[model samples]
Target: MMAGQEKGDLSLVALTKSFATFTAVHPLDLTIPQGSFFALLGPSGCGKTTTLRMIAGLEEPSGGRIHIGDTDITETRAYQRNVNTVFQSYALFPHMSVMDNVMFGLRRRGDKNAKAKAGEILELVQLGQVADKKPTQLSGGMQQRVALARALVNRPDVLLLDEPLGALDLKLRRQMQMELKRIQQEVGLTFIHVTHDQEEAMTMADSIAVMNAGRIEQLGDPATLYEQPRSTFVANFLGQSNLVRAQVNPGGTDRIVTVRVHDTDLEVSREHLPYGVDDVWLGVRPEKLRLGEAGGPNQLRGIVRDVSFSGVATQYAVEMPWGQELIVVQQNDGSARAVLGETVSVSWAAHHGFALDASQDAAAGAELVEDHG
Candidate 1:
């Protein structure tokens, strides 16, 4: 854990898990500050669930340490850890009412006021009106709320949520996202949520740890992860991007460098770029690329291939001579889109793109090609 890590903070150091000859998760080192809404995001079998299970003590790590607050709970039993998990399945009893389900854990702990606490939590989750209803009588969203109230009834120091909103419809999922964030803020409990939904992670988490192939590719706040990704995987995974080939050239100071993209060569401030070599891959977000009104240092001429209206924004597929197709998205304000087959000038500012290494570019490019194809 870092020096500033506070009490009730969660820490995992050199955490590893394996099954026979296959390694499910590599050694992970992460320190989550107390009262933070943190997310472990990745695809299925990418080790995200395994990491969460380790933290919850549901699956013992093959090796490493797990700590909550100032105490080390590496070898602690699952019930001994001050953590509660809200799984995808509500796991509520079919015969029991909502209040009883919420009070189940507290009853096991022999709390004399468990019934009162359960009633209070049901109201907190806005399920007070359905306190006497069974799990089968409740809607999908209502069932999920009951699960959340059940997990939180004990007032655990940390809460683990594994795709808690997976079964809800799109509209309900959006509503629950806000509700979950609000509840976390109100309780001030550390939350470690696991999900594959990028938008959900972006909307609710204070900080996200994006995992790929059993390792954390990048971990930071949403703005930093989206604006200045350190690797190609990070850049391409979060959202749409235009990864153009480029060559780096020496500039005035060792910290600065010039990048050549296609037919344009422009100076760039390389303060955040760690790679000091000449060969690089530049990544630009779709919104950063402006159309029409030419004459810029980094400019490219391309023919518009396709355009689609999406209510809030318009998407365009532009083609270049190199057989590369770039995607650009512009907000809709009742303005007409550029006609297909029209030659338009595309340009962006220096701060809009980040240089990437060859290996990172290769990974990003392969994924882009696969996604577009």
Candidate 2:
């Protein structure tokens, strides 16, 4: 059996990267506690990968210090650091057996128990039976486990996963997400995952840092970020949100604020309102709204312009009297469903609405459609 590995907390202070005239990563400070699964999530060109590379010592920082616990590894070479990286490509040595490939690193490090250590890691990754197989003999998921085993065999203080599941199909990708989480928990190693997939990050990471324009826009647990996004980019990027312009009524009570949207007056929690703003963009998630009679605290009248049905839920686009269309999603329960061309009133609780500064771009999260296209 192999010796237990020491887990180290990772910290970045003023880390920055630049490419001539453009800055890829702005100077930023972040701390990842030991044994936590932290994710750096963002769209392409947002510097998530660049940040991971810097942590792995593959990319020299333009300015910043990287620390693993008390040790400063900012100037250390990639091979000299106590860290390992698993990339999108498995990068396994095809000529060597899986067991041999895993032992190569340990043997190179002068460990006499390389074979035994490799065997233990193989079993840890659930690939013990495939230890004799070649890289080509394994499925995509198995090959990935082998790659992980090779890295973990070295007993690094931290593991960096850079879109490691990008090559797998949807079903396999999801399965790997769960497997990776299990592996991380079993090893208790600090895991820094870089990905653009929001669902994947939310599913596996204990905490996530949402990056945009080479800087972090928001950082929190998945539920906090989803239910109460601080910025328009985060609100729209993490998931769908219905943002409508509204004017906050002055002289409001401390616990609640009255916001006027179109012809409707919505009572929103003061805690959810943007700091020091009279005019704001009210935000609500589609699923949080109920399309029915106007008996709730906040209600709006609209004409059902379109309706689309998926197996699990039905989505409706309702056009308000002021000409703005709002989208609503309802579960496919046995309850009656709204039809197109019908006049309907949608209502929701007072606290369901979130407010942001009116000056912020209403189209902050609009890039998702173009990104997928």
Candidate 3:
């Protein structure tokens, strides 16, 4: 850690970055707890990478202050701030053995026990047996671990990971996610990770900030952001959501507001719709909808347009009367499944939904869903 910068949260105040007419990052403010795993998540060109670069002091902020704990390091150079970054490329020296590559940084600073310090970090990342091998002799995952070991050996106050797992295969990427979380907890260092993969972010980070169009759309724990998305962008990005157009009905004015979707009426929790609005989007997750027409508070009738089976679960694209398709996901647990062209009734509890302002585009983040999933 930088002198006296220990145990203080990383704070960014009024941070901004711009290029000609395009603003990469708007004026922003955020605080990250010390010894925590925080993720900046969004699709490409969403300013997540730019924000990470700014935090690393690689790209100077247009207007803002960066601080570590109580110490202000806004004007400090990257190396002087006690911060290290590990990139996706795993930039290791191919000519040098793993041990020597890790020890190079320590030895450069004239540390007396560079070899011992390097060995300990190598073991922490579970790459001790391969210490004598060159980078070319190792697998992609092992090379990534070598890069992590090299940075951790520096013992920096904060580590910035710029899509560190982007180069790995799908199976290896999942494995590295677990390994990264384990290493973070054991080292007890503040880790700031940037990635466009939603699953990767949710699997590793304790807290996540979802960015869009150079601004933070939402920030919270994984479950909170996935369960109760505040806007259409968050709803579609985190996971699949079945959002329908509805109007707040004046007939049943109770503690919970009732909204009319076509001819059916549904209730949204008062907490969801803090302010009264004439029109709203009733949002519910695909998994929450059941394929039963039985007695339920909320029910909608639709024709099954498409059916997809992915072993774990079956997904049905049900087209409603208004030509809107709502997806319903059902687990394969020996229950009767709906088929294509079959008329079915979908039901869900009223409290399972959330209401958003109708003014927002219903398909705001639709095009980017595939990249996230």
Model 3 deviation from the true structure expressed as Cα RMSD, one decimal place: 1.9
Order of the predicted models by TM-score, top scorer first: 3, 2, 1
TM-score between candidate 3 and the true structure: 0.95
Q: Give the TM-score (vs. native) of candidate 1.
A: 0.92
Model 2 CA deviation exceeding 4 Å by range? 1-7, 369-373
Q: Quote the lDDT for 63 in model 1.
A: 91
What is the alpha-carbon lDDT of model 2 when measured against the actual structure?
0.88
Following a full C-alpha superposition, what root-mean-square deviation does model 2 have from the true structure?
Answer: 2.6
lDDT of the structure predicted as candidate 3: 0.87
Per-prediction count of colliding residue pairs? Answer: 0, 0, 0
Pairs of residues at least 3 apart in sequence or in different chains that clash in candidate 3: none
* Number of the candidate with higher TM-score, 1 or 2: 2
Q: Tens digits of per-residue lDDT for model 2 on 133-153?
A: 999999998989898889888
Give the per-residue lDDT of model 3 (tens digit) for 254-331: 557788898888887777774768898899999989998542578889999999999999999999999999999998
TM-scores vs. true structure, each candidate = 0.92, 0.94, 0.95
Order by lDDT, highest first: 2, 3, 1
